[model samples]
Target: MRIYTRKGDDGTTGLYFGGRVAKDSALPTAYGTVDEAQAFIGLARAEAEPGSELDQLLVAIERDLWVLMADLATDETNRAKLVAGETLVTDAMVASLERRIDDLSARFTMPSEFVVPGGNRVAAALDVARTVVRRAERDSLAAAAPGSRVVAYLNRLSDLLWTMARWQEGDSLTARAVAPLAGEAEKGA
Candidate 1:
């Protein structure tokens, strides 16, 4: 089959179980941002040790994003077609993230101040994914159904990403200011 269907050439994209909407619409924009986050999570997974816990966890999160995107892509008309934990985001998914966050947080000493990213390549990639997830959460707010859990899942996913980055980094760098050089101090005086 040809890769290009030319369906979206008209500036509209297909939805999950049915219908289509403009390419720039809320659902597409939200799911597109989620797709971006999933790619970054893949980058972090690549940096993680093969078959290791971090790698395995990232793989799970990446898979979950597909479910999330499915939830986001489906219009309200087809909402009844979505199955929990399959094509829809569920409370259990958010709870799982919370559990993972607690577990990973317990494995490390929480930093007292705001963290600076780039503690390591894997951690830095995770940090990047976390920020993208934050954006996805914000975008999902506009696209989610009244009682949908997509936004909650994205919110918890970001927290989990932050915890994972800190776990991988061992010692996270703080955003606190450092002492100035002697010449700078003299100039100030």
Candidate 2:
């Protein structure tokens, strides 16, 4: 099959069901951001240690993003065709991210201050992926339709990526700065 259909030469793209819309429309913007996030996640996965838990999790997330893009590409009229756990984003998908975050967050001390991203190659790549996921979350919210669980999924995904970045960095490698309590330091003296 020829990759170039020449159908979008007029700056319009096809929706999943049949209709076409401007390439810059809300739906495409949202899914395009998701695609960007998925690519960065791939980069992070490549940087992860071979056979490590981080690598495994990134692979799973990449698969999930494909489902998310499909859901986003579909028009609201065609939403009934979306199969949960496959083409559709579901509550369980978001819950799974929360569970993973909780599991990983338990392994490290919560950062008391802003973390300066970039402790190592893998961690830095994960941080970049996390930021892109944040953008995707915002775009998803804007493009959301009734019966769409994509917003919830993207929301939890950003949280998961943030937690994973911290998990990969651990305590020793995480760059953090803390401020002393107002008068506590003087009182101690």
Best by lDDT: 1
* lDDT (10s digit) by residue, model 1, range 1-189: 899999999999999988999999999999999999999999999999999999899999999999999999999999999999999999999999999999988886788766777888999999999999999999999999989999999999999999998888884344334456789999999
Q: Model 2 over residues 9-118: C-alpha lDDT tens digits?
A: 99999988678989999999999999999999999999988889998999999999988998999888888888897989889998999999999989988787777778
Q: RMSD to native for every prediction? A: 2.8, 3.9
Candidate 1 regions with alpha-carbon error over 4 angstroms: 172-189
For residue 119, model 1's alpha carbon misses the true position, in angstroms, by 0.9
Q: What TM-score do all the candidates reach, one by one?
A: 0.92, 0.90
**lDDT of all predictions:** 0.92, 0.87
Report the backbone clash tally of model 1: 0
Report model 2's TM-score to 2 decimal places: 0.90
- Which number leads on TM-score? 1
